[model samples]
Target: MAETTGGVIDAAERDLIIRSQAGDRAAFGKLVEQHMKRAYFAALGFLGSHDDALDISQEAFARAFDSRAKLDPGRPFYPWVYQIMRRLVFNISRDRKARGAKLEAATGWIVDDLSARALREGPAARLERSELEERLHGAIAGLADQEKEVLVLKEFEDLKYREIAELLEIPIGTVMSRLYSARKSLAKRLEGVV
Candidate 1:
């Protein structure tokens, strides 16, 4: 694997990129298969709508394919695809806000299998965890879009500070700052609950 500005690019993925750039649908499908879930979740983190995320993620891939000739096989693929998806997520989010539509809280995004754990910890513990997750999701949803974006990318997507910076095209310090602000806001929101 070779490290590029985007990230690590394995040989197979690089070949897929090359073939994809040559207008090979199967190669492009392979690329999409690698990234589609992450793309949808990334959009969901921003828009908080499953339907919107699905649509925007797919649309991003379509647009990416349309501009396939511009793809650089040397770099990792997801970052480039993420750039496309991010724009669509933001545009739709802004439009919804402008029209006074409430962005749904991504309450369902976090999933923990509590059935077995519940047997061990009891129903009360499960209920508490479920409630905590709800509160956390609500607090996260209430964050400013920038703060939310940084938080989701870091905490949920599990991207490193450098990776988040590269993905968002921002400085690492900015990413850290936004994450700090997000944490503080979440703390304030969950002060009593937690």
Candidate 2:
């Protein structure tokens, strides 16, 4: 029963990936449907704009499809897609800066539904939650590029420390230390806010 369940889950995931690789539009659509919101949120968290997030998400999938044969079926798809999105965002940021353009944060951008849902509960509760999220975002933005990358991959992407170390091509101990420092710095910044 245990093997059967695992096999069924693996089969389903592989089928989707295979069909997508085979140029089945519906299958590709299903893959996108499964991952879109998560990818969008990740992009938004990094790029800080709905428009840029949408563009990055779309471009990532396009690039993935174009290079589908390069993907290893044994690896999880989300992380691969996220890496593409991260690269695209970085490129966009670099290009904008090269053109003497400044990136602006979208004003009144709520990170997610939790803040709005909390608002419906009560004003005092909502205010506190919003302040915390704002502080957290600010702290994350302030982190060095490598530190922020490690933190986001470990925390938001739910990657294991070893997986992050592998992805970042750093040692496992380095991943742990970076995450610890990232959290510590965030906590210190948040303490002043709250």
Candidate 3:
């Protein structure tokens, strides 16, 4: 999905945005319906926790609604809401006193893809997979937030370089470079498993 850069808009979404900005309840609901899931998953990938993702995403939406007048109809709604979500996540993650506790609370959002062999090969294989999954999660969690943000947006969200750059307000080359550095770091950490 291409985002509206420089406040460009398509007609249908433009109508929704206008109505939403005008305090139309149903129109705002429509906007929420369209973007909530994306916002949740984006928060999940950024914060590395299910509960924080749900709470923060909802709060971001609420804040967006409260600040509806500031919304530019010519811009895409999701990206606008996304900015709010990202800022909340960043602030929480950067808080020295709360960061460790938050990280501890953030497990289980990242699930390992259990293979069919987990059932067939029984306990040992299952244990190994579990260990590797935990290790990989830790490795990923250990990355600097910027690298992790780039990795999550590109790999987990499946965003294109341009899209990631646009969302991050950076050049496309910077997005690719960050992703490359993130992958290299993750690979080094996971070398034992793969």
* Overall lDDT per candidate, in order of appearance: 0.83, 0.72, 0.81
Off by over 4 Å in 2: 1-9, 95-103, 111-136, 154-171, 187-191
Per-residue lDDT for 71-155 in model 1, tens only?
Answer: 8887888889888887787788678778877656456665656534755797888777777778877787678889989988987
Candidate 1 regions with alpha-carbon error over 4 angstroms = 1-8, 113-130
Estimated TM-score for each candidate: 0.84, 0.69, 0.88
Worst window of 10 by summed lDDT in candidate 1: 1-10
Q: Pick by lDDT: which candidate is best?
A: 1
How much is the lDDT of residue 105 in candidate 3? 51
lDDT winner between 1 and 3, please give it: 1
Q: Give the CA lDDT, 0 to 100, for residue 106 in model 2.
A: 36
Ranking by TM-score: 3, 1, 2
| lDDT for each residue of candidate 3 in 1-194, tens digit (9 for 90 to 100) | 43543345677888898998888989999888888888899888877878888999999999999999998877888878888988898887788335465365534777645744575779999877877777778777778888989898887888888888878889998988888898899899988886
Candidate 3 regions exceeding 4 Å error are: 1-8, 96-99, 105-107, 114-117
**Tens digit per residue, CA lDDT, model 2, 1-194:** 11111112255656777888888878878778778897887776666678888989999999988888887655556667777877887787667657855335633444567687887989888887777777766677666556667777776767788767655557899999988888888788888665
Q: What are the per-model numbers of colliding residue pairs?
A: 0, 0, 0
